[model samples]
Target chain A: MRYELYYWPEIPGRGEFIRLALEAGGADYIDVGNRSEEQGWGIAAIETFLGGEVTDFPPFAPPFLKAGELVISHVANILQYLGPRLGLWPGDEANRLWAHGLQLTIADFTAEAHDLHHPLGPGLYYEDQQEEAARRARQFISERLPKFLGYFERVLIDNPAGERHLVGETLTTVDLSLFHVVEGLRYALPNAMAEAEQEAPRVIALHDRVRDIPRIAEYLASDRRQPFSEEGLFRHYPELDSDG
Target chain B: MRYELYYWPEIPGRGEFIRLALEAGGADYIDVGNRSEEQGWGIAAIETFLGGEVTDFPPFAPPFLKAGELVISHVANILQYLGPRLGLWPGDEANRLWAHGLQLTIADFTAEAHDLHHPLGPGLYYEDQQEEAARRARQFISERLPKFLGYFERVLIDNPAGERHLVGETLTTVDLSLFHVVEGLRYALPNAMAEAEQEAPRVIALHDRVRDIPRIAEYLASDRRQPFSEEGLFRHYPELDSDG
Candidate 1:
C-alpha cells in the first residue's frame, strides 16, 4: 500500500525520521505537505487532517502517516507501525518490542535536542530565550548529550548480534533512527559532537553504514532530502554550542 | 505472570502512568524500586538493569517493565505492552494503535509539564532556574496547556464510539493515563486548571469516570498509590503558576 506522510513543507523536523525509514525500506509513499497546493496537496492537506474534517482520531500534530484508513501520529508510533509493514523491522514479538523501546528513547533525545533552542517554551522565539537556550545547550552538551550517546554506545557494544545492528542481526528502524540522531548532532553541535564521537565509534559506524545503503545514499543526494536549517529541530547556533 | 516495574522509589513521576494501568487492570506486579534493599530490590535492582548486568536493552531512564525475559522501557511502550496483556485494551488492531497514539500524546504532555519547573535543564535545580521556569510556566498555562487539553477535549467529543471512551467503546489504558494527567494538573496548577477545565468538560468528565472505575477507585485510596509531590513531574510552585 502507498503511504501518505503529512508534515510541514519547509523544515525536515521530525518528519525526517519517517522519511529516512521509508526511503531506506524502498516503500511507495508521497510527501504530502511538500507538494504544491495547486496539485491539491501541501499545507492545506495537512491542515485538513488537523481540522477534524478527516477522521475522529485527529493527530496532535503533523508527521502523521496515513495508510488507507489508519492515520498514525507521533514519530515513534508512526515508525513502529511502518517498520514491520515496510520490512524495516524484524517480525518477531520480542525483537519488535525492543526496537520500539529504542525508538522511543530516540524520541526523548530528539525532544531534548529541540529544547536546547527553545528552553523557555516553543511559543517563544529563540532570540527571546537566547539566555536560557544557551544555559540549556551548555548542560545538554556537557551532561545529557554524552549520557544519551554513551547509552547508545553501550547498546551497540553489548548487542549479542554484535555491534552491526541495534536489534537482532539485521538493519531495523532503530539503526536508521540512530543514524539520523548522529547526523543531526553532527550538524547542530559539530564541536561537541566531534569530541563526543570518540566514545561512540560504533554508533558513528552505524550512521555511516546507513548512509551508504544504496536507497538511503540516493535519497540523501536527491532533492527530497531537506538541508539542516535553523527552522528545524536541530538548529546550529554557534553561540549556544561549545567544544565541551 | 508477575510483572516487575523499575522506577525511582520516590515520586509519582512517569511511573505513575504505568502504576495506574497495573492497579486498574488488577495485574499482579512488583514495585521493585519501592522495596527495601534488604529484600534484594530497590534502587539497586533498578541500577542493575541500567548497569548492563541484566539485558542488552538497557533503558535510558526508569519506569521500565520486566515481563519474563523481556524488558520494556518508555511509558507508552510499557503501557502498550501491558494494555493488551492485562485486558485493559481492545483486542482489535485499529483501536490498539489509536490507544497507543493517545498514550504517547499524554507522554508528551507530561514532559512539557515537567519542563514548567525546570525550563533551563533537568540537571539544574528549580531554585537555580526559577526565572526561566517562571517564563515557561506563563507560556505553558496560557498556550501549551490549553492547546493540549482542548485537543483531548475535541477527541472525546468526536469519538464515534461516543464520549464515554477515547479509543473504542470501553475503558482502556489511555483513559487511565488521561485521568492521571488531569489529576496531576489539578494538584500542580490548581488555579489555572480550575479555570481551564471549563473549556474541556468532556476531558474532565472522562477523568472523573476513570477515577470512579471500581479497581481504580480502590487504588487511589490505597497506600500503593503514591501522592503527588514537589519532587515529581507536576510540581506546584505558586510563583510559576497563574489563573491564565
Candidate 2:
C-alpha cells in the first residue's frame, strides 16, 4: 500500500523525520506535498486537510500522513503510526512505545532547535529577533542542545539490549530520528555541534551509522533528500552559532 | 493494577495531565515524587529511573507512568497507555490512533505555552530572560496561542460525531486535555483567553462541560487539583497577558 505523506513542499521542516523512516525502510510512499498538481498532489491537498475540507480528522498542520482511511498528524504521531507499519520499529508493544517516547523527546528537541533561530515566534522573521536569536542560540548551544544530545548519548550507552540502538538493539524509527537531529545540528551550529558531539560520542556514532545504512545512504545522495537551508528547522545563521 | 506517577512534586507540571486521567478514571495510583523517602518513593526514585540505573527504558524526563511492568514517559505516551486501560479512549485501532495524535498535538501546545515564559530554555531564571519572555509572550498571545487553541476549537466544532468531543463523541482523553488547555490559558492570559474563546464557543462549552463532569468536578475541587501558580506550565504575569 502506498502511503501519502503531506508536508510543506520546500524546506525539509518536520517532514524529513517521517521521510527518513520511509526512505530507510523502503516503504511504498509518495511525498504528496512535494509533488506537482499535475501528479494529483500539492500543498492544496495539505491545505484541504488542515482547512478541514477533507477528512473528519483534520490535521492541525502539515506533516500529516494519509494511510488508507486514516489521516495522522504531528511529527511524533505520524512517525509512530508509520514506524510499525514500515517495519522500522521492533514489532512489540514495549519497544514500540519506548521508541515513540524517544521520538516525542526528539520532537521536543527539534522545536527547541527551531526556536534558536526564531526565539520570538514563527510569526517573526529571524532578522526581527536577531539579538534575541543570538542570546537564545547561546543558551541553546551551551546548555539545551548539549543537554538533549547528551541525554540521547547516555540512552545509547545505557541501553540494556545493546548500545547499538535506542530500543530493542535494532534499527528503529528513533535511531533514524536521532540521525536527522544530529545532522541538522551539525549544519546549523557546526562549531558548537562539533564540540557537543565530542561529549556525545555514542550519539555521533549513531548518526554516522544511520547515514551509512544502504537505503539511507542512497537516499541522502539522491536529489529527494532536501538540503538544509535558512528556511528549515536548522538554519545556519553564523551569528547564531557559538564557536565551540 | 496501581500506577506510579513520577514528576516534580511542587508543581503540577506535565504530570497533571496524567494525574487528571488517573483521577477521572479512579485509578489507584501513587504520586511517587510527592511521596516521602520513608514510603519508598521520592525524587530519588525518579532520579534512579532517569539515571537508567533501574529501568532499561529510561525516561528523558519525569511525568512518566509506571504500570505493572511498563515505564512510559512523555505526557502523550503515558496518556496513550492509560487511555486504553482506563477506558479513556476508543478501543479500536483507527480511533485510538486518532486520540493519540490529538494528545501529541496537545503536548505541542503545552510546550508552546511553557515557552511563552521560558523562551530561552529552562536553565535560567525567568527574570534573566524576562525581556525575551515578554516578546515571546506577546508573539504567543497574538499568533501562536490563539492559533493552537483555535485549531482545537475547530476540531471540536468539526468532530464527525458532534461538537461535544475531540475524537469520538464520548469523553475521550483529548477532550479532557482540551479542557485543561483552556483552563490553563484562562489563568495565564485571562484577557486573551476570554477573547480567544469568543471565536471558539464550542470549545469553551466543551471545557465547561468537562469541568462539570462529576469525577472531574470532584477532582478539581479536591486538594489534589493543584492551583495554577508561577511555578507551573501556565504562569500568570499581568505584564505577559495581553488585552486581546
Candidate 3:
C-alpha cells in the first residue's frame, strides 16, 4: 500500500523519523508536502491538512501518515502502528508495548532537545529566546542527557539477548529512534555527548550498528537524508556544548 | 486484577488523569505513592519504580500502572492500554487508534501546560525562568491553547457518531482527558480559554458533559480528586491569562 507522509516541506523536522522507517523498509510512500507545488502538494497542502474541514481523524500536528483509510499521528504512535507493518518491530504485543515505551522515552529526549533552543515557545524564534535557551541547554547537557543516555545504556546491558539492539535482538524502530537521538545530541551537544559516551558505550555502539544496516547505510548516503540545520530540533548554539 | 499506580503524592498532577479513569470505571487500584512512607510506598517508592534496575521491563518515568506483569508508562500509552481493559474505548482497532491519537494530543497539550511555568528547563526553578515563562505563556495562551482546543472541538463535531462524546456516543478516556485539559486550561488560562470557547463549543460541551457523568461526578466531588494547584500542570498565573 502507498503511504502518504504529511509534514513541513522544507525542514526534515519530525517527518524525517517516518522517512527513515519508510526508507529502511523500502516501503512505497510519498512525502506529500515535499512534492512539487505544481503537483498540488506544497505548503498550502500542509496547511489544508492541518485546517481542513473533512478530517475524520484530525491530527493535532503533522508528521502524520495516511495508509489506506488509516491516518495515524503522533510520532511514537505512528511508529508503533508502522513498526510491525514494515517489519520494524517484534510481532508480540508485549514486545511492541516495550518498544513503544522506549520510543516514548526517545520522544521525551527529543522534546527536551528542542526546548533547549526554544524554551520560550515554538511560536517564537530561537534568537528571541536565546537567553532562556542557554539556561535550558545547561540543564539538558548536564543532567538530562546523562540520565536518559545512562538509562538506555543500562537497558541495553540488561537485555537478555544482548546489548546489540534496544528492544529485541534484531533492529526495531526504537533502535532507529535511539540512533536519531544520539545523532541529534552529537549535533546539538557535541562535547556533552562525547564526554558522556563512556557511561553510555552500549547505546553508542547501538548507534554505530544501526548505521551499518544496509538500507539505513544507503539512506544516509542518499540525498533524502537531510542535513541537521538551525531550523531542526538539534540546532548548535556554541554555549550549549560542554567540554566535560 | 488490582492495579498499582506509581506517581508523586499530593498534587493531582499527571496521575490524576489515570486516577479519573480508574475511579470512573470503579476499578480496584492502589495509589502506591500516596500510601504511608513506612510501608515502602511514597515518593521513595515512586523513585524506585522510576530509577530501579529492573531489566525485565522498565518504565522510564512514573504515572505508570503495574497490573499483573505489565508495567505501562507514558500517560497516553497507559490510558490506551487501560482504555480497552476498562471498556473505556471502542473495541474496533481503527477506533482504538483514533481514541489513542486523541489521548496523545491531550498528553501533548498537558506537556505544553507544564512548560508554561517551567519553560526554561524542567531542572530549573520557576523563578529562574520567570521572564521566559511570561513570553512562553503568552504564546501558549494565545496560540497553542486554542489550536489544541479547536482541533478537539472539530474532531467532536466531525465525529460521525455525534458530539456528545469525543469518540462515540459513550464516554471514553479521550473524553475524560479532554475534560482535564479544559479544566486545566480554564484554571491556567481562564480568560484565554473563555475567549477561545466561542470557536470550540463542542469541546466545551464535551467537557461539561464528562463532569456530569455519574461516576465522574462522584470522583470530582470526592477528596481523591485533588484540586488544581500552582504545583500542577494548570497553574493560575495571572500574567499568562489574557482576554485576547
Candidate 4:
C-alpha cells in the first residue's frame, strides 16, 4: 500500500524522521501536504482529520503516516510500524524493542533540539524569547548536546552485535534517526558540533556512514532532502553556537 | 515472572506510568531504586547499569522494566511490553498501536510539564533558572496545559468504543497514564486545572473513573503511590500556579 505522509509542507521538524525512513527504505509514499487540495491531498485533509472526529485513532499532531486503515503518529511509533514492513528493523523482538527504545530517546533529543530555539514555547516568536533562548542554548551546547551524543557513542561502543549499527549488525530505523540528529546539530551548532565530535566520534562516524548508504546518499542529494532552516527543529542561529 | 523496575526512587515521574499499569493489572514487580542495597535492588544497580555496559539494551535513564530476559526502557515501550502480559493493553494490534501513539503524546505532554520549571536546562537548579521558569510556566499554564488536556478531551470524545476508557471500552495504559496526568496537573496547578477541566469534562471524567478502579483506588491510598513533591514530575509551586 502507498503511504500518505501528512505533515506541514514547510518544516522538516518531526516528519523528517519518518521521511528519512521512507526514503532509505525505498518505500512508495506521497507527501500529502505537498500536493493540491484538488488531488484530495492537502493540509486541509490533515486539519480536517485533526479538527473533526473522523478516525477512532486520531493523531495529536501532524507527521502522521497512514498505511491502509492505520494512521500512526509519533516519529518513533511511525518508524516502528514502518521498520519491519520496509525490512529496516531486525527480526528479533528484543532487538526491535531496543531499536524502538533508541528511537524514543532520539525523540527526546529532537524535542530538546527544538527547544534550543523556542525556549519559552512554540507560540512565542524567537525574538520575543531571545534572552531565555540565549541561556537555554548555552546549556544545550555545553551539557545536553554532549550528553545525548555521548550516550549514543557509548551505545555504539557497547553494542554486542557491533559498533557499526545501534541495534544489530544491520542498519535499523534508529541509525537513520540518529543520522538526522547529527545533521541537525551540525546545522544548528557547527562550532559546538566540531568540538562535540571529538567525544562522539562513533556517533559522527555513524552519521557519516548513514550518509553514504546508496539510497540515503541519493536521497540526500535529491530535492526530497529538505534543507535546515530557521523554521525547522534545528535552526542555524550564529548567536546560539558555542565556541567553547 | 516478577519484574524489576529501575527508576529514581524519589519521583513518580515516568516510572509511575509503568507502576500504575502493573498495579492495576495485578502484576508482581519490585521498585528497584526504592529498595535497599542489601536487597541488590538499589539506585546503585541502576547507576551501574547505565554507566556500565551490562545489557545489550542498556537504558539511558531509569524506569526500565526487566522482565526475565528483556530489559525494556522508555515509558511507552516498557508499557507496550507489559500491556499484554499485564492485560493492561488491548488485544488487537491496531488498538495497541493507538494506545502507544496516545502514550507517546502523553510523554510529550509530560516533558512540557517538566520543562515548565526547567526551561533553561536540567543541569541548573530550578532556583538558578527562576526567571526563565517564570516565563515558561506562564506559557505552559496558559497555552500548553489547555492544548494537551484539550487534545485528550477530544480523544475521549472521539473514542468509538466509549468515552469511559481511552481505548476500546477497557482501561489501557494510556488511560492510567492520563489519569496520572490529570492528577499531576490538579496537584501541580489546582486553579488552572479546575478552569481547564470545565472545557474537558470527558477527559476529567475519564481521569475520575480511572482513579476509582478497585486496584487503582487501593494503590492510590497505599504507600506504593508516591506522594507528589517538588522533586517529582508534577511539582507544586505556588508561584507557578495560575488562578485562571
TM-score per candidate, in order? 0.98, 0.97, 0.95, 0.98
For all predictions in the order shown, the interface RMSD in Å is: 0.8, 1.2, 1.2, 1.1
lDDT of 4 at A181: 89
Output the lDDT of residue B162, model 1.
94
- Report, to 2 decimal places, the DockQ of model 4: 0.80
lDDT of 2 by residue, A1-244 (tens): 8999998987788999999999988999999878998767897777878888878888777788899998887888888878777888888787777888898899889989999888788889999999988888889987888789889988888787888888887798899998999989889999988888889888877888999999999999998888899989999999888755
Q: Deviation in angstroms for A21 in model 1?
A: 0.8
Worst 10-residue lDDT window for candidate 2 chain B reads B91-100
Output candidate 2 Cα RMSD.
1.4
Q: For residues B1-244, write the lDDT of model 2, one tens digit per residue.
A: 9999999887778888988899889899999988898877889888989988887788888889888788888988888888878889987677887888889888878988998888888878888889999999989988887788788888877777888888887887888888888888889999988887878888889989989999999989887777889989999988899865
Model 3 clash pairs?
none
lDDT digits (tens) for residues B1-244 of candidate 4: 9999999886788899989999999989899888998878788889878875577777878779888988888999999888988878899878878889999999989998888888887889889988888889889888989999888988887888878888888888999999999999898889888888899999988888888999999999998878889998888888888865
In terms of docking quality, model 4 is high
Instruction: Kindly indicate the candidate among 1 and 2 with the higher DockQ.
Output: 1
Candidate 3: segments with Cα more than 4 A from true spot: none
- Model 1 TM-score on a 0 to 1 scale: 0.98
Q: To one decimal place, how large is model 2's interface RMSD in Å?
A: 1.2
lDDT of residue A6 for candidate 4: 91
lDDT string, candidate 3, A140-241, tens digits: 878888889999988887677788987878888889888888888888888888888889889988999888989999988987677888888788877768
lDDT of each: 0.90, 0.86, 0.83, 0.88
* DockQ, model 3, C-alpha based: 0.72
